[model samples]
Target: MSSDNWTEQDVPDQRGRVAIVTGANTGLGFETARTLAARGAKVVLAVRDAGKGKQAAARIAGDVTVQTLDLTSLDSVRSAAAELREAHPRIDLLINNAGVMYTPKRTTADGFELQFGTNHLGHFALTGLLLDRLLPVPGSRVVTVSSTGHRIRAAIHFDDLQWERAYSRTGAYGQSKLANLMFTYALQRRLARHSTTVATAAHPGVSNTELIRNTPAPLRLPVTWLAPLLTQKPEMGALPTLRAATDPAANGGDYYGPGGMGELRGTPKRVASSPASHDEAVQERLWTVSEELTGVTFPVE
Candidate 1:
């Protein structure tokens, strides 16, 4: 358990490390990448838009590069992994930070729910494909960003994974975020044998980011009015993830989030997740389903 004041200044030196952060074009991902790069890590801004990615890299003051990665497309994920593996044979950190929030009922290019496909499945395949590179590097970490939304009407909904019967944007978004936590737990258990690599999870407590673009109109005004009091800046929100990615004391399967009330808007610290997120059965089942859906298998047992 970290203290209630674990700010970015507490992050240890990251010189000689290599980090890949998805969706690094803006928001929390950009802050995470920028902070790590500032500390001397070679950071890759893996995003879907090359122009935006290059623009983001230009804003950072360290060795930052851009790579194309569209999580909605498995083909793109594979290509990105191959490119990353060739460029960085040993990855010290892989931050699964890309995600879509509450959007209208939609499916990915591969016909899966957009949120689940991109947030969970895409990252699942990418991690499996790139696991080999991290395995040889001691202390390597794969930090997946989940969300507080996971506790809001979240369930695996195995039978209706695609929400074909009915779709509530909130429900689908929660499911995807919950999947992120489950994936972290399951991956950590599998990677336990290697002792070289670890899996962790983090959440930014209600940060002011572009992720809320799809919020219902009714709640938009109230949210905007309360933003100053309810939301933290993106840089502050990135603390938990940065800590999870670089904290030497952070253990596999550990979850980091804001230390403030309701795990929102404060410094980073170890935090507890919803009870539903701790179900081993659901985690295992989701893992199997993800493997089948993505056609990607882990190197671990």
Candidate 2:
């Protein structure tokens, strides 16, 4: 396998594997689900809208199902997990690929900042709730998709986690993405003893996806102009995630993303995250806070 130019063809056979991908209705998640299903995995599109999810599943020619999941609400997350657990006694993959980017300031049903709640906390809780299903399965993995946006104005912001004092869409997004990596590392540590299930993270870099719908007005024109040069298609964007989820060599705590200039776009490869994302102290603190906020605890702990 060419590590530097790894592509979807590099994915190994996934026969009989049960894979769940959040927000699988379109873009990166859709591409990820499509490739995994093509490789013979039983793909479940866990999306917010059941109708859209079914539509997407129908378009993919493989064994696929739809599970309604709205990450903004803890109730919905738990409900979806329960349903999934009942249907799948064992899960081979859980991809936390659903997320909101640079949205206007708002709170989720549980009252956390929209981006943080939906992007990091929602996946954190879901992973904890369904971790038991992956624990016993050999070679099972939990792959969370993060982004390069994690570096811009990113921090734990322990003092104002929800941005009650002030708000910047970019800052909130950064915090959420950074938390994704932190959660991956922290979860990997807890799963270290099990040796069967691993936790990893990946970023799509800059992809031309619906996620950019909320781009601030000022940057819209420039972003549109640079899109062709800086952004990759969703198919290419999903590669880093595919590699992290199924690559034979992908291990716990590994982070994968584009190998091109500034990791904006190109082939998927092993990549490094920001220094701040590696802070174990912050990671543990965030974990504790997440447990407190979501009231969900990991069985691995």
Best by TM-score: 2
Clash statistics: count for each candidate: 0, 0
TM-score of every candidate relative to the true structure: 0.98, 0.99
lDDT of 2 by residue, 1-301 (tens): 8988899999999999999999999999999999999999999999999999999999998999999999999999999999999999999999999999999999999999999999999999999999999999999999999999889999989999999999999999999999999999999999997657999999999999999999999999999999999999999999999999999899999999999999999999899999999999999999999999999999987
Pick by lDDT: which candidate is best? Answer: 2
Q: List ranges where model 2 is wrong by over 4 Å.
A: none
Q: What's the lDDT for all of these models?
A: 0.94, 0.96
* Model 1 TM-score relative to the real fold: 0.98
lDDT of 1 by residue, 1-301 (tens): 3466787777788899999999999999999999999899999999999999999999999999999999999999999999999999899999999999998889999999999999999999999999999998999999999999999999999999999999989999999999999999999999998656999999999999999888878888898999899999999999999999998899999999998888888998899999999999999999999999999999996
Model 1 regions more than 4 Å off:
none
